[model samples]
Target: MSFNESVLGKEYLKYCNLKEIALNTKTLDLSNISWFFPTCLLPLGIFIKEHKEIHVIPPIDIEVAKYFNIIMKDKIDSVKRSYIPIVEILPNKKLIEKNLDSLISNKDYNMGSLNAFAYFIGELITNIYEHSKFSTAYIIAQRYNQKNFTEIGIIDNGISIPGSYEIKGFNFSDIKALEEAIQGLSTKYNDNEYSERGYGLRTSLNLLTEGFEAKCLIVSRGVGLIANKNNRFFYKMKEKDIFNGTLISTRFDNNIREVNVYAYIDT
Candidate 1:
């Protein structure tokens, strides 16, 4: 299959992804684009006054797609689709924790949610690090004031959900494989203890959505998790085969002020 077809799908779904967002939004009369390092404010002020949209998609491979999603979700009007690159996402706990500290800081998220966010990020990153071998990986985080929530997405261009299932010695043709992966029963690792004892994804799903409107999606495997919504883990692959990589996304309301991470501090 062609890269794009294998990567996304042959149908091209809707162009409302990241590529279009990056190019088109910049043309709008009210667009404000900013870059870090030097932190130029003059350009931001001019764009804000004259443009209709503002986006902050880092140059990193994975951030492109996530940046598009964040801007589109926050867009007040119509948004065009775009194609964004996926990056290598490592699973090291230290790297993951550092990323959380840098991206999802205290200024935006609350205490408990931040803690949960760190946990979820760590788990997802760990999964990516341990399972896939992609060269690029990134996590995109954005706050939605209208929805009173924050969305975080981790994308990688490694093994997909179905591929992950296949590696576990299960038959890919079996529809039950999807269910197994979604229910957290698949051979996530070669060792049973590592997969079973690993509470990253499981605990993340439980804590992030506890008594709140939270959702998680593993696009690499065509599986999704949603609480109090259309909560079902289904496959969305076009080919009868597996997926290109994975995208673990989660969203939670903004009711917390700080995160308690004593349990995971050592990790």
Candidate 2:
């Protein structure tokens, strides 16, 4: 079957469906893809990298193919022995820290902002190991000079937010699960008890909006949340397709200077 999305709608059910089938099938065809959002590309790349049995047919759209190549270059190179790009496979904390240092050092970003970025990355990655049961994760970052913004993406294939909450005896739709998640709640804490254990996503989003005037998108299961300085919106997917994991993408301005790193950590 051919899969294509022109705008790559706010909901990610389509990609989720494709990922599920691709994981089970011997060879997954991808030659029909025409357009895709960065949100979809991140998880798709992770899926392709982890599953060795799946062979993908390159996208027909030239631009889409280029993006697939950029994000999946490291994985592709492993099999084809070609030049790889900047994508990093995050297997441990030391490598994550090292990659962030290299990325920050390459630019002239302010020290405070750099520190906050490091903190954010650490918190997000820690959450994966502490809460998410997935064994593999990927990190990709890009500094867009012309757009005056930098984007950092973390992708993991694991239990979704709703799945985690469900395990704790709480019932929430995917969208509601994300809403509660970013509010500093977690399945790790009992339903009746108040705890500060799962503040990673909330604190990170707060730092991005409050400290750096940035934006963020978090998707898991069939829902997604988008937050920026002006507004926050949530989308609940109607489609049956689902991505059984999480993707965190944040955008920060290149010239950001003042940031409240302590505030995020303390809160």
Candidate 3:
């Protein structure tokens, strides 16, 4: 009925079933999927990108359609400026700047620690283009006015953590690989200077969830690693039919204390 319920409730199974079918065939049917979480965007985009001839059916529900289009389509104007969409996964700061601009323009947000929020989002997105094989990616955001929380969702189409490790002469299950990644083990190393590549995911998770007491979710392949302040857990999902990229959802409460986002990535 509502957005969250439609996404996390029964429609989830429908989305999964559609995704499973799309894996074998070239058609992605979204007729049953009235909505989705940020976790779904990565696999959805990858499916479209991977199978060039794939047919995607937009949701029949008008409200859901609008939200879906806002995320999937790249349009910026007076009416739609509240959100910015990036269709290509490139190492471009301009995209990040656009996101920052959107956040500022949407006065509904309190924009606590704007600089830190900017860096937090920028670093995560940048990592996608730099590593992840850069196949395709998507970014979406939503503001919960009453709740005073802004959620940003980002995902990429590439070799997931487990797949990356497998390629590097090491094999680990999806859960194990996700744990390794969150623990700050990056398969990538910066070409110049000290290794600044690995800490982005871990640092952001710690700052946003631990420091600000926000909720976070990281989906890589078949598992979702979630953190809420001091507690961290996971959900096994999608199995072999999972997204090849990483998907992250960061929730920020407008009333939270300021954070020095840069200080978290000292490693």
Candidate 4:
């Protein structure tokens, strides 16, 4: 069980069961419910006071599905249903800006961490706009804790990153392409705009160490997957089609314990 898995699992067990009980109760306590809801429990919290039955949508783990079903089983026939806990569904361009706003607004993130997040988000959105030509992209942002830890995901239905690279004249497989991308190599962009070549991908990875402690999971075209943390790197995706385009998730320290957001700028 990884850190997030443990956190989410605990939340699933607590909240799913609570929603079953809270549905029938006339008045529900918001603070008490926060225990189970955690930061990840969003829009679902909207129905905490009124809904009697809660059904969590699928595309989640089987264990979570089983327990979620168990909680809703007896609560069936209830007149109350709520939307998914997701905050907002965003397109590619807006998602990056929105995440930057979030990173800036939250007081828990420092400028360095916030900047790192901003750059990472920039790279991701750029990848989407630059690669996924099939459809508009969709991104979801969720805050999971007060400790400066947040999860942001950008999803697209277009071909995966590796596929995009192949289309761009790269014959390499997923792992090969991903490695190149993370290490600062580029199929299209220069390695370093300032240093004479492509550097966005590599620069972002390097920033993980210099500025703060962070972890990133990148699934791109020919690049199957990779993650970097504490100066050590690991492979997370192996011959798996996470999706077309890429899904980049990162957790970083916000640099500051408090951020006004309005004052934080890229300049």
Which segments of model 2 are wrong by more than 4 Å? 1-38, 50-55, 59-70, 73-105, 190-192
Per residue, candidate 3 scores C-alpha lDDT tens digits across 18-134 of 767876776776766555554455456556656667777777888666665544554423324434333344446465565556543455433546666667777777677656775
Query: Best-fitting candidate, measured by lDDT?
Result: 2
Candidate 2 per-residue lDDT over residues 121-173, each given as its tens digit: 77887788767777566766656566677667777887878788888888888
lDDT measured at residue 90 in model 3 versus the true structure, 0 to 100: 43
Q: What TM-score against the true fold does each predicted structure earn?
A: 0.56, 0.74, 0.75, 0.52
Query: Candidate 4, residues 90-178: lDDT per residue as tens digits?
Result: 34456445434543343444564566556655665666666666353433343544554555544454676567667878787677777
Residue 81 miss distance in model 2 (angstroms): 22
Better of 1 and 4 by lDDT: 1
Give the per-residue lDDT digits (tens) of candidate 1, residues 45-91: 22233344555434344433333333333222112121111222444
Model 4 lDDT on a 0 to 1 scale: 0.44
- How accurate locally, in lDDT, is each candidate? 0.45, 0.68, 0.62, 0.44
Residue 246, model 3: Cα distance from true site in angstroms: 1.1
lDDT sort, best first: 2, 3, 1, 4
What's the ranking of the predictions by TM-score, best on top? 3, 2, 1, 4
Superposition TM-score, candidate 1 onto the true structure: 0.56
RMSD of each: 11.6, 5.6, 4.7, 11.3
